[model samples]
Target: MEIVEFGSDDSGLVARFVDVSNAVRRHDAPWQHLQTVHAATGMLRHGWDGEPAVPFLATHGGDDVAAGEWHVGNYDNLHIAWLTVDVHPAFRRRGHGTELLEALVDRTRSAGRTSVGGDGWDNELSRSFAARHGFEQKAVEVNRRQLLAEVDPALVDRLHAEAAAVAASYELVRCPARTPDDQLPVMAEMVSAINDAPIDDLDIEDEVFNAERVRAYEEAHAGRGITLHRLVARHRETGELAGQTVIGVDRERPHLGNQHDTSVVRAHRGHRLGLLLKTGMLQWLREVEPQIEEIDTWNAESNNFMIDVNEMLGYRIVGRALAFQKSLA
Candidate 1:
């Protein structure tokens, strides 16, 4: 087996990578959308927040067998690297996955990272593989999806109205596409509220967010051809941003949407802002992105607050994933 790193410019290799990814998705997560070449290229080039991962393709006997990437954060979690390994369904049990993982671990250690983390669908195969590799399960996450066709407008209206009444002191502000330059500062501050979410014993640090980081995030999404629809709640009197919810709609696949982050500042909790923000987003998307069919989101199993809100909005559990970590030290 041979492993070689490839850049975004190498369209041939990128397409091969997407092929393996789609193959794995079909076998492992048939309900999930397939990956497109354009989206994969953008991800390889722009990454999540302008920090692209180092992607590698493994080939055996002139046939592509596995794909992997190692991602390290520049702003926070500086001591750890996140890894992903996807083996072609037809090529599994041939030691391709393990070999690719070994290469990723080597790169992680060479990057001076003390810990490495990876996540996979909850299954005996995934669990035993991690355990055999000396990794410990640290957290569990539930993936829930909302199908627009099944949502009740009457329910959404009632919830939004109830939340609005309770949060009468605040107003919802619609921010479509990219955030304005003037709002980056406040957006950064409010985005940091995600730090309050449950980590479930994962060895990580609070992500540092600022104006620059916010800009980078918007740009990265734009580069991936995703239109960002963000709804923020602001205090009526003080005009401070209290909470926000963001959804990204894919341009290439207009029927698909992703739930980004929904958070409220610690001082502003207990006002039903979470419900207000999410319900407001649903209403706003109805008008702007009626083409969207399904939206997916993930939450730590321990985050009952957010899960309750999601469930109330008709989000149903689609799958569960396990996060595993290994200390390189």
Candidate 2:
């Protein structure tokens, strides 16, 4: 088998990789995974807006075998943003996946990066592959979904009112545009604090969420088809970006139509801005995509605060995953 550098930005290559990756994803993740992949891939390719992305291809027996992707982002450690191998259903036991993975390891060492990162669901093959790669299990990214059709409107309304009453001075807007480019510095610092906010057992090395990375995320992750429903909490007295929550809705969901990211700035933690933004985002979801049956989200397993807010909003844990990693050196 020959391992090669094909690069992730090649549209044809990306499409081909998606063909296999999506197939495996179908067998593994919910339909929303495709949308997230589509969105992230687009961002990852948006003029390299994300961290540097490297793609490697594997081929043998005159057939396309697999591809691996690495994204060098804000983490002090160079991370393997994605790695997927498609052993033709016919080629499963022939050890093609193992060979490609070994090759990826060699490449990482040559590149001078410290580690690799990727997430996988709680499945036997996934867990086994991670273990075989010299990776230890890390945090579980809890995936949750709430069906709009079954939502308790009275409860939602009550929470909405209560959250709003407490956060009365702030206004809600639906796009990242409301977040000014100038405030990128403050936005970066605030997000950095939150990124550095308490989480259990993550090998995070530095607080790297900054202005450039935030905008790069915009160009790379939250692109056009996916709209960012961002509600910023401005200090009533200071008018600074004290708190914010952002949700993403992809019109592409097969059954359930939206997914969201909700966060509240640390300083505004006690004022229930988290509650306000979540309730506001739910309200927006209800009005705009009433057809959307549910929305999914992920949070650190140890994140009691966000998890509690989600629980109050009727979100339930649907599945769990491990973010596995290994040091390159």
Candidate 3:
């Protein structure tokens, strides 16, 4: 068995990595959309918030059998490294997964990270794998996809109206594909509201956000051929940013959309901003992106508030994922 590190520039190896990943996805989670080489290439080159994970591909007897990655945040959670190991379905039970995991753990420790974390679909196979590695389940996250075609237009109108009535003191602002130069400051501050979301027992720190990070996020998404639509709620009198929701539609797969974030500032709670932001986004997408068939989102099972709003918006569970962590110490 041999393991080799790769970057986005290595087109040949990256293609092999995508093949292994798509195979794993098809076997483990067929409900997921298959990955495209173009999207995978962009992700490897420009990761979330501009911090790309280090990728490794493993081969045995000249056949690629598995892939792995190790990622750490540049702004926060400096002591932990998030890792992933995916063995081709046909290659499972051959010790490829264990070999790849051991290599990734070594890299994590070499990076001075004291803890490593990863997530997989909540299934007996995944659970047993984590348990065998001495990793503990830290949290469970539900993947929900809202089918736009199944949504009732009247129900959306009614919900939007009801939320608008409660949030009468605020107005929605439609941001462009890229946030304007002036709003980046407050937008950075507003993005931090996501920290309030529950993490369960995960040992991680609140992500640090700033104007630069916001720009990086937008750039990263753009690089992946994703069109971003952001809607922000502002106080009518004080002109402050009260809350916001962001959704991204892939230009390559225009029929599918993704829910990025929907957060309400702490002081602006109880005004139904979460509902307003999400419902308003749906209405806007109908006008601008009428071809979108579904929008996918993930939320911690412990996040009842967000879950309630998602349920009200017609989002249904597709699957649940289990997060697992182990201390290298």
Clashes of each: 0, 2, 0
Per-residue CA lDDT of model 2 for 256-324, tens digit only, reads: 544444566666667788888788777876776566677787788888888898889888887888878
| Candidates arranged by TM-score, highest first | 3, 1, 2
Score candidate 2 by TM-score against the native.
0.83
**What's the lDDT for residue 63 in model 1?**
92
Stretches off by above 4 angstroms in model 1 are none
Q: In terms of TM-score, which candidate is stronger, 2 or 3?
A: 3
Clash pairs for candidate 3:
none
TM-score of each: 0.98, 0.83, 0.98
Candidate 2 least-lDDT 10 residues = 77-86
**In terms of TM-score, how similar is model 3 to the real structure?**
0.98
List pairs with backbone clashes in candidate 2. 43-220, 114-328
Question: lDDT per residue, candidate 1, 1-329, as tens digits?
Answer: 99999999899999999999999889988877899999999999998889999889999998999999989989999999999999998998889999999989999888899999999889887898899899999999999999999999999999999999999999999985677899889889999999999999899999999999999989999999999999999999999999899999889999999999999999999999999999999999999999999999999999999999999999999989999999999
State how far residue 126 of model 2 sits from its true place (Å). 2.2
Model 3 Cα lDDT, one tens digit per residue, 1-329: 89999999999999999999999999999999998888888888889779999999999998999999989888999999999999999989989999999999998899899999999999998999999999999999999999998999889989999999999999999998788778899999999999999999999999999999999999999988889999999999999898889999989999999999889999999999999999899999999999999999999999999999999989999999999999999
